[model samples]
Target chain A: EDQVTQSPEALRLQEGESSSLNCSYTVSGLRGLFWYRQDPGKGPEFLFTLYSAGEEKEKERLKATLTKKESFLHITAPKPEDSATYLCAVQGMGKTSYDKVIFGPGTSLSVIP
Target chain B: GAGVSQSPSNKVTEKGKDVELRCDPISGHTALYWYRQSLGQGLEFLIYFQGNSAPDKSGLPSDRFSAERTGGSVSTLTIQRTQQEDSAVYLCASSQRGVRGSNQPQHFGDGTRLSIL
Candidate 1:
C-alpha cells in the first residue's frame, strides 16, 4: 500500500520563525509530490509539485524539497497569515496503470504574532 | 468558474438519508477529483475522472459511494444511506489534465461540510 506520513503533528512558532515540516512516503512509482495549505473550514490551496528527487520549488515564504523517500516543506520567516494546516500528498503510478494520490496527516502550523 | 466550485457549503441530515454533492471544475480542466477530509484526518482520495477515460473509483470506501462527471465539466458525488462516519468535508479538485508527468496542480474549492445526525 502506498502510504504517506507527516511529522510534528502540531507546531507553534513565533512570527518570523523558520522551520521545516516533514512528509515520508512509500510508493511503487512516484509521479509527483504536492504541497498544500488549508485553512479551517476551507479547502486546500496548491503550493508546489516536486516530481523527482533533488528537486525543489518555492513560493514566497515556503520552499518544498523532495527526496526518494521523503519530502520537506520549509517555512521561512513565517507570519500569522501563514498559519494553516500544511498538507503533503504523493501521486503514484498504480499497478492497474492508473494514478492515485495518497495524503499525509497534515502538520498544523500556527504562527503567533 | 475561475476556480473549482463546490455546492452546498454545509449540510446536516439524518443518518439514513442520501446526499449528493456537486463540483464544477475550472473552465478547461480535464481532470476532476473527489476527496473526503475527516476531522484530524488527512484528505482521503475517493474518486478521480480524467477527460473521457473511465473514472478510478478504487479509493472509494464502500459501494454506497458513487460519482459521475458529465460533459467533462461538472461532477457529482452521491452517498446512499449516509452513516455517521460519513460526516466530513467533501472536497473537489481539478487540474489541467490527469496524465503522468503533466505536473498539473489540483485546485480546490471550499468544500461541502456534511454533518450526519
Candidate 2:
C-alpha cells in the first residue's frame, strides 16, 4: 500500500515568516509526487509535480523539492493570503494498468498579519 | 474555456436520504476523478474514470456509494441511505490523458459540500 505522512500537522507563522513543510512517503514505486494548496471550502489547487529525486520547482513565493523518500515545500516570506492547507500525494505503481494516488493528512498553515 | 464544474454546491439532508452530486469535466478532458474531503482533512480518492471505460471504484468506502459518467462529458456520484459519516465535501477533477505516461494535471471543481443531518 502507498502511504504518505506530513509533519507539523498545524503551523502558525507571522507575516514575512518563512517555513517549510515535509511530506514523506512509502510506496511500491514512486511515479510522481504532487503538492497542492487547499483553502477552506474550496478544492485543492495544484502547485507542483516532482517526478525524480533532486528535482525542484518554484512558484512565486513557494518552492517544492523532492528526495528519494520525501518532499519539501518551502514557503518564503509567507503572507496572510498563504494561509491554507498544504497537501502532498504520491502516484503509486498499479497492479493492472490503472494508476492510483494516495494523499497525506496535510499541513494546515496559518499566516497572521 | 471553462474549468471543471460541480452541482449542488451545498446540500443538507436527513440521514437515510439519497443524494446525487453532479460533475462536468473540462471540454475535452478524458480522465475524471471523484474525491471526498472531510473537515480539516486532505482529499480521499473515491473513483476514477478514463474515457468511457469501467471506472476504478477501489477507493469507494462502501457499496452504497456509486458513480457513473455519461456521454463522456458529465458524471454523477450517488450516495444511498446516507449517514452522518457521509457528510463531507465531494470534489471532481479532470485530466487530459492517462495512457503512455502523460503529465496531465487534474483540474478540479469547486466541490459540493454535503451535510447529513
Top DockQ: which candidate number? 1
lDDT tens digits, residues A1-113, model 2? 78899998999999999999999999877788989898887888899988889999999999999999999999999999999999998886766535667789999999999
Interface RMSD of 1: 1.5
**lDDT per residue, candidate 2, B4-99, as tens digits?**
999999999999999999999999998889999988877899998987778899899999999999988999999999999999999999888544
Name the 10 consecutive residues with the lowest summed lDDT in model 2 chain B.
B97-106
Model-by-model DockQ, in order: 0.75, 0.63
lDDT of 2 at A48: 93
TM of each candidate vs. truth = 0.95, 0.95
- Worst 10-residue stretch by lDDT in candidate 2 chain A? A92-101
| Range of the 10 consecutive residues with the lowest summed lDDT in candidate 1 chain A | A93-102
* CAPRI docking class of candidate 1: medium
Off by over 4 Å in 2: B98-103
Instruction: Let me know the TM-score candidate 2 reaches against the reference structure.
Output: 0.95
| Candidate 1 lDDT for residue B5 | 90
- Model 1 CA lDDT for position A102: 78
